[model samples]
Target: MATEGSNSPLRFASVEASVPKITIQFCIQCKWNLRAAYYAQELLQTFSTSLGEVSLRPSTGGVFIVTLETFNQHSVLESHTIWDRKRDGGFPETKELKKKVRDIIDPQRDLGHVDGKKSATNPPAHPANAGHTRELKDVAAQVVDGPVKVSKLQDNRPESLGVQLVQAQNSSKSQDKAECEDCK
Candidate 1:
């Protein structure tokens, strides 16, 4: 098997293109498009290295799968584009993981409630919410004609001060009329 001063053409090609490239192939059902994209993003992060890059260019010819590149370090990825090099490998489709992501991106979450309260965990409440509270109250006031009152809010968190003030003013006016004894 010894050829003097000659490398086989195939061997030469292999050597010339020695930088390992990995092509990962998997079937993704088209129905779950959102889940598919999320999985792709998570998968990319796992394999990203400063050595080169791991990229997924979805195929246009109906063959849809993700590929990874090893930069040809012995090209161990020839068989599988599987890049979980760690002993404790990462799998994307564990049942528990799916549930957690589903909960986080819940589709029906009310935007106002989720982003309303200021908390350490939440991003600061929206800055342009200055007129929101008043708008909400005004909308509510349209249907219900019951006296809407507001109470003093100086020492407490913001609470209604209008209705209470109206009642007090009415009471004081009635008392003045009663004391005057001018009209029954």
Candidate 2:
């Protein structure tokens, strides 16, 4: 009973009604079907289990909008606009779109590369390693037992006053002795 001019997508009786739905409306006059379909496929592939359906609705006047709809316990449908071409400035990038959709349906879910660039050289340190700087520990432990020496202030500035750090000479001698004993 569907007509050719109808923009409504086909639905099945077996489809689950509880899961969140995504609707992407693109301008048919602008020939954006492929672009809309691409976004739909990306969303479905990323959130296969969390989303129920991603419908592509045709529209006119250069309209491109993505919306999410969720059903509450009372079965009241709550709709939120994820992207509006006019309001959002233009179509969203693939990663940005995925991030937005993920935030809406499953906020805790991680989209891997879509999440963002991560520095490989300096990965985030664990909380347990916060106070475990070996160099600082070694330097502090080797401090010579003597009166604290305050050097002459530079440029007559109180902030520039330097505190001289003296390392225990006996500490190096003990380390050398230990290395010799290990060799023996």
Candidate 3:
């Protein structure tokens, strides 16, 4: 018969052997593929041993979502979203993304200098001649203002269901206006 001590080690080993899988999906329509891939690379680099796999799925309609899936006995035990663009509004910073993954993978693990309070309060010193620096918010605004080539026939594509829905709503509004004008 296995003693309590032996069972403890077995239980611990089983728990340690199971690592969660992470999937990050980004909207191709929103031009977020590069951003999603970057985040996937960062997460894989940071939690290589703790993560089972990291997948990048292309989607549409401004979707930028990160999900974690835990498995037990060859079946998914739990699945949850780490972030959603519709809820969070924008891409997360690299450090912030690291923190989120760390929280889920190893809650007790310390991120050393990355999680220090001073690191949060002070900006890292840069070389004097590094040229003008812009805040993240400013850079984000510039990216938003940058021209994006939007295809006029996107509504006809199956991947652009959200675009189709928006077009339908707009046409219904135009039809209502036309009917009201006829009554006048």
Candidate 4:
């Protein structure tokens, strides 16, 4: 039996101390703590294990900067500014921020729709379901009567219903075109 007070020979877990650190310095006078906190939450959520620490430093002068610090091959700490409000001309969108961080931590990651392009490697969340095409078309045929409630269309429907709905709606608008090029 193992004693409760005994010093165990093994340590259960360990954390990597060499992971990169992220710092968001926002203007305290401008009350940008919430903005900084939002970015921190996003980064932590997206790269939970990839980051060592995320710090929110209060600053002044309309400053909003995001810096990533990592040790180089030579063991020298190097800091890179990912985003600077003044230099970038404005605040970054959530998707844009995610892409920026993803590029640094995991470049091969697929952000799907956030990447703004549809490729074989990064396909849509839901593809068209041929088996349900007739049902989707029937729903699309309702446009002749009046405007349809797309929100209510997804109830008790397949996960790919939205993609089909968009295609159906668009095709109805332009009968000559059966494809939804802008579905994404």
> lDDT for model 3, on a 0 to 1 scale?
0.66
Please list all clashing residue pairs in model 4, or write none if there are none: none
Off by over 4 Å in 2: 1-18, 117-184
In TM-score terms, candidate 4 sits at 0.53
Off by over 4 Å in 3: 1-18, 72-76, 117-184
Q: What is the lDDT of residue 10 in candidate 2?
A: 67
Model 4 / residue 21 / CA error / Å: 0.6
* TM-score of each candidate structure, all chains considered together: 0.24, 0.53, 0.54, 0.53
TM-score of 1: 0.24
Number of the top candidate by lDDT?
4
**What lDDT is reached at residue 19 by model 2?**
61
- Clashes (backbone N, CA, C under 3 Å), per candidate, total 11, 0, 0, 0
Worst 10 residues of 2 by lDDT: 175-184
What is the C-alpha lDDT profile of model 4 across 1-184, one tens digit per residue?
3468887654556656655999999887666789999999988887788888999998877788999888778987888899999899879998898898788777898877678866567544445554466666767677655556554444565545444333223343445533323221
Candidate 4: list runs displaced more than 4 Å.
1-18, 117-184
Error of 3 at 107 (Å): 0.7
Predicted candidate 1 versus true structure: per-residue lDDT over 1-184, tens digit per residue: 4377777543433334322233333222222234446655553343233213323433222233433333225544433333321222433453333233223333243333233444456576576665556755664564255544544433444544332333322223444332211112
Error of 3 at 55 (Å): 0.3
lDDT of 2: 0.73
